[model samples]
Target: MIPLYLLHITTVEHSESLLWTFLTCNVFVVTAGIVFMYKLFTQKKVRGAGIVFGIAIAINYILIAIFGDPFDLLG
Candidate 1:
């Protein structure tokens, strides 16, 4: 809700669809951080870190990979 709250604070009239937009972004980031940190703490290989980071980035862009647009922030 940071983006929406910030936008709200800034008083910009963002599309109402921003509720989902922010949710998706938060889920992507939180999942990545949790999974990556888990693997980092559990795994021994240095590659684990790399893979985690890559997956984190990939998760954020998975929509673009499949849907074409970067993020459907509006709708």
Candidate 2:
């Protein structure tokens, strides 16, 4: 996602494409993190991975907020 965002910064015309890909990647990561948490709490599975994913989710949110959404640049 960071790489795509960097590329998007360099390329002007393909901004939308990069933003879409970046957003998709972010959504996928966030979804996976939620799934991990659910499985960990409900099924008592993915013990170690669940913690890692939870941290990842937090970091992703922070970074996304700091960087700002690429889609916002479109308008």
Tell me the TM-score of each prediction against the true structure.
0.43, 0.43
Model 1 weakest lDDT span, ten residues long: 6-15
* Ten residues in sequence with the least summed lDDT for candidate 2: 6-15
- Cα lDDT listed for each candidate: 0.54, 0.59
lDDT of 2 by residue, 1-75 (tens): 576565234233445664675566567666777788787778766877677777766655554454556553443
**Where in model 1 is the C-alpha error above 4 Å?**
1-11, 44-75
For candidate 1, the clash count comes to: 0
**Per-residue lDDT for 2-74 in model 1, tens only?**
7555422323334557545645655666676776777778875547666766776665466334443333333
